[model samples]
Target: MKKIQFNLTFFLVVTAAACSNRYQTNNHTAANKADTVQSKYINQPLVSHIYTADPSAHVFNNRIYIYPSHDTATGAPGNEQGDHFDMMDYHVFSMDGVGSKVTDHGVALSLKDIPWAGRQLWAPDAAYANGKYYLYFPAKNKQDIFQIGVAVSDKPEGPFKAAAEPIKNSFSMDPAVFADDDGSHYMYFGGISGGQLQRWDNNVYHADATNKYGEELAVLPRMARLGKDMLSFAEPVKEIKIVDKNGNLFKAKDNDKRFFEAAWVHKYKGRYYFSYSTGDTHNICYAIGDNPYGPFTYQGIILHPVEGWTNHHSIVQFKNKWYLFYHDVQLSGHTHLRNIKVTELTYNADGTIVPIKAMK
Candidate 1:
């Protein structure tokens, strides 16, 4: 075995340098050079060396914050495999604007510190509501059942604390929450095993999906509502799927319509855009509907697949331009050790999204 030593002095120097306004001004100046890909084009693998994947980008207090699932190398603490995804913690990075130097805020939370979770922390998302910030994450309990939990903090860069227990009676992962303009909050969660449909029932959670496990053959993307507090559900609902422009649902076995995981929702110009990683785990595709919880019609792929076996992302508008946040395996040459990337997104006047070409 080997022990790795850290250079505290060097780390402090680098941290201070990164925080200095002069360094940032220089970086921004370099970014503006026409020869710079960051200024002219989207420079990728937002973080280098370490594998950080499954990006959840958000806007809080006018800055762009990215919450990414931290990927540990084989045999590192909490990693159970040498050749697959074995994440156990999360890190947050923020920037004043796109193409700016990202400030690493360090570890926001770790599975080992969560009293009620196992060490397989997967994907996570965050939301702001009720004067505090909340982190929604999924991990297996001691019994190995995957469950969703919420952590809270006063700041987006957080010392987030997981609740004593996961959302009661919930059984899924990849929790994505949206706070609507009407003073209401909703949560969209589920993955792989046909997404669970849930809602806020009288400020508490209730079964939103009618089909129990084994009653179905494939995974269907599901949606539900969150209470004002953003933690409870009302009742179970229906699975989200591909539909024609006429609003008819796709047949059960339509591979193109089948949901694999990573459900995300956003609204632009009164259209509810539902995006998810398809069953192929390659492309990030989306559908649009008239309402937040929708009978959305399949549009097209937002991102073509990278080398990774899984894909997860979030869409956000910063400074009036749209950007897609996702990851790829190009850095490590292995699917489990992926790196986060971003690219500018464009759209047609009819609200149809122009497909994105992901950078390595």
Candidate 2:
């Protein structure tokens, strides 16, 4: 009787394992199917079918394309550890020509295709330069520490191919790339708590050092000049430090602009606007400077927190109108999964953006 019981329990365990594998396979298959059916919607909260957030928008070849991260619960086997962001893929959305249909170019990149990535993807940015479209993303490695990677494609909406490895001197995440009018390329990146920053030195591909508070770098967001290849840094000393409203900058808990993450920089009417999600993670604030690298004075909030604890945005002027793309948690019923929202961002007479509430 004891032997019979042991064999029956063994059979049950094997069956459960097989069933679990089948479930995962089915879910992935369904996701693939959904990726192909690009739903059409014209409203706030751009995507509702699947949770999507962290929008990075740009005007490419007279059309607007958005690269956003996929939002999900910690994936597969289940998050027995509770809820956390679990983005394994990315999708690109575009409005081909001004009044044409909004196209969802599905699965621009996915972790299943990248061998080095530890199966986690985060906020990403894209740019068109030198006849190629580039996608910069921050993802974790097998060790669970996050680093940035770049992928390339001939088309704005891509079936992209990633480089063999990540960008050498990249650390943290939320990579925002900007191409200047003079054909120069720059990238803004980083995010951490208590104003501590981890960075890569020219001497070390991995960050062997930590930047402390009160330094020019700690309080400000960092931007590096990209090499012609767009994968390496060109100048070490020219890294940017974010400035504040009073010609000052953020510090480690010493100042009000304790910039948490989401570094977004855009130029408006010859003035560079440096915007970011402040620490409390609920506000998307801005500051204006004279150059791409800023000595900016704080302007004001472009987006205020609504229901979620984190906020991120991208600003773009499309078809002669400016729009702010950000995310919130109203649809998910919990903060772990989020949805993207869009609204018209208005500028004051003095060039500062009027504070706006996040919708949908």
Off by over 4 Å in 2: 1-43, 75-83, 96-101, 194-219, 237-239, 254-256
Predicted candidate 2 versus true structure: per-residue lDDT over 303-338, tens digit per residue: 777567778889988877888888877666566587
**lDDT (Cα atoms) of all candidates against the true structure:** 0.74, 0.75
Clashing pairs in 2: 219-250, 220-242, 245-298
Counting clashing residue pairs in each candidate, in order, gives 13, 3
- TM-scores vs. true structure, each candidate: 0.78, 0.78
Model 1: CA > 4 A from native: 1-42, 75-83, 193-218, 251-253
Model 2 has an lDDT value of 0.75
Worst 10 residues of 1 by lDDT: 194-203
Tens-digit per-residue lDDT, 75-110, candidate 1 = 644231222456888898999988888889988999
